[model samples]
Target: MSNELDTLLTALYVDLEDRVLPSLGWSRTHRRGRRPALGDAELLCLAVAQQLLGVASERHWIRYARAHLTGMFPQLPGQSGYGKRLRAAGPLIAAVITELARDVDSWHDVLRLVDSTPLPCAASRETVRRSDLAGHAGYGYCASHSRYFWGFRLYLICTA
Candidate 1:
């Protein structure tokens, strides 16, 4: 990993620790159960860093982080564990994004850019029918790409 990337990761962790968690009222015991090797904040930062660097596949991200980012994330879990942690942290991640956008709005930018993308989910029609997302996700067509998609759409509104 480059020094610049390291700096970004450090900054992200700090922001999450200082700003995000407290605002969300999340404590170390918030999700009481089997303790994870990495805390919610650390795992969130790792996942965000992976996306920021454009690492598409979680498996690939885990492998890369295991090889290169052990110093930053000494407790990084294996692929499956990391995937599960990230999935569980979805709400936390969303909360962080909203908080960050609000912070940016207050500190500097009032203008926000909003966009969305289809999050293709169900693997088959059966899955779509049975999945919890059945009511929320549906078949939709994308005009820009001329493609049919089945899933939920994620809209992101952020500071310009």
Candidate 2:
């Protein structure tokens, strides 16, 4: 891992342990099951760092982490495990981001931007008909790309 990645992981882990986990009741002792080899803080940091690094594919991200980040995340999960963990941690991740954003001193009261994009789910008609996403997915036209997509829309609100 690069020094930057190391620093980010360390700082995030510290903040999570010290500030967030206590309020959220996510301490290791409160968790059940085989007790994940990887802690919640580490998983959250990994997910956020993955997003920050623009890694869109979970499989690719797992492979990259296995090869390059093993030292930082000694117990990195496999693809499926990582997917489940990250999905479970979604709400926590969002909370963490909101908390951190509130501390951004440089951008206070500046222009805030919100944007959204489509999250493609089913492609073919048959797939769309049979998919669990049938109710949530809808036909949407992508004006920027000049194409049609069938999926749920993802709205992102953030400072830009």
Candidate 3:
């Protein structure tokens, strides 16, 4: 809606279409079956925009996009369709992220920052006992909260 956001989206879409998608060998004609109304680049742009706008729920994002971004994205998919496309585009998304990160100046920096957060898988003792994550997940203490949790640690490392 804002001028800055519109500019950002435009620039992002151009970069994706001209550089990222082609480099990944993802041309519009490569896929089989009926062509989607939304192209891969456009879908990826929408995904990035959703993240930038902090719209977490796919249903809510679809509603918001339909209301606010319809001018930019004329043909929008339904919530379920968007979810399926997003799930299927996971590998493409990862590849794009990698490619984009490589272009960032700090990506090659030696200095890095590391963080770990608790990803709670279960709360109840019974649930923990029956959960399939028994072998992979275990009890851990979160120093920040001064509490114990039954989950796996999610670690994130980023360039400084």
Candidate 4:
């Protein structure tokens, strides 16, 4: 890894471990079950690095991490294990994101933009019937497309 990436990861890890995690009252030691080989802070850092590096696939990310990030994360989990852990860490990830976003100078800006897009969960009648989103997702019209879609709406709000 380049020096810039190393610096960014180090700073991110410190901020997460010392500030973000503590503020959220989350401590891995307090939780039950076996202590994970990869700590939450490290996992979160890994995720940030993956996104920054534009590695979309978790399996490929794991492979890359194992090859290049062994120094930072000595005991990285396998692809499946990593996926499970990442899923379980959703709340933690959200919290970290909120904290980091709040720290940004633009967070308090008055100018904001909001938009929504259709997230089609199912298409065919049989697929729609079998889909777990049967009740949660419903038919909605898309003004832009001039068509109806069956799924949930994804809204995004951000500062201008």
Error of 3 at 10 (Å): 0.5
Q: How far is 139's C-alpha from truth in model 3 (Å)? A: 24
**Prediction RMSDs, each to the true structure:** 11.1, 10.4, 7.7, 8.9
Q: Which digits, one per residue and each the tens of the lDDT, describe model 2 over residues 33-121?
A: 78888888889888877888899999999998998888888999899999998888888878777777767875576776788787889
**Ranked by lDDT, top first:** 4, 3, 2, 1
Give per-residue lDDT, candidate 3, residue 67: 95
Off by over 4 Å in 2: 106-160
Q: Cα deviation of 89 in candidate 3 (Å)?
A: 0.2
TM-score of each: 0.65, 0.63, 0.70, 0.70
lDDT for model 3, on a 0 to 1 scale? 0.92
| Candidate 1 residue lDDT tens string, 23-137 | 8897787566787779888998898789888999999999999899999999988888888878888887888888887776455757778988878887688888889988888
- lDDT scores of the candidates, listed in order: 0.84, 0.84, 0.92, 0.92
Q: Global CA lDDT of candidate 1, please?
A: 0.84
Poorest stretch of ten by lDDT in candidate 3: 23-32
Off by over 4 Å in 3: 112-160
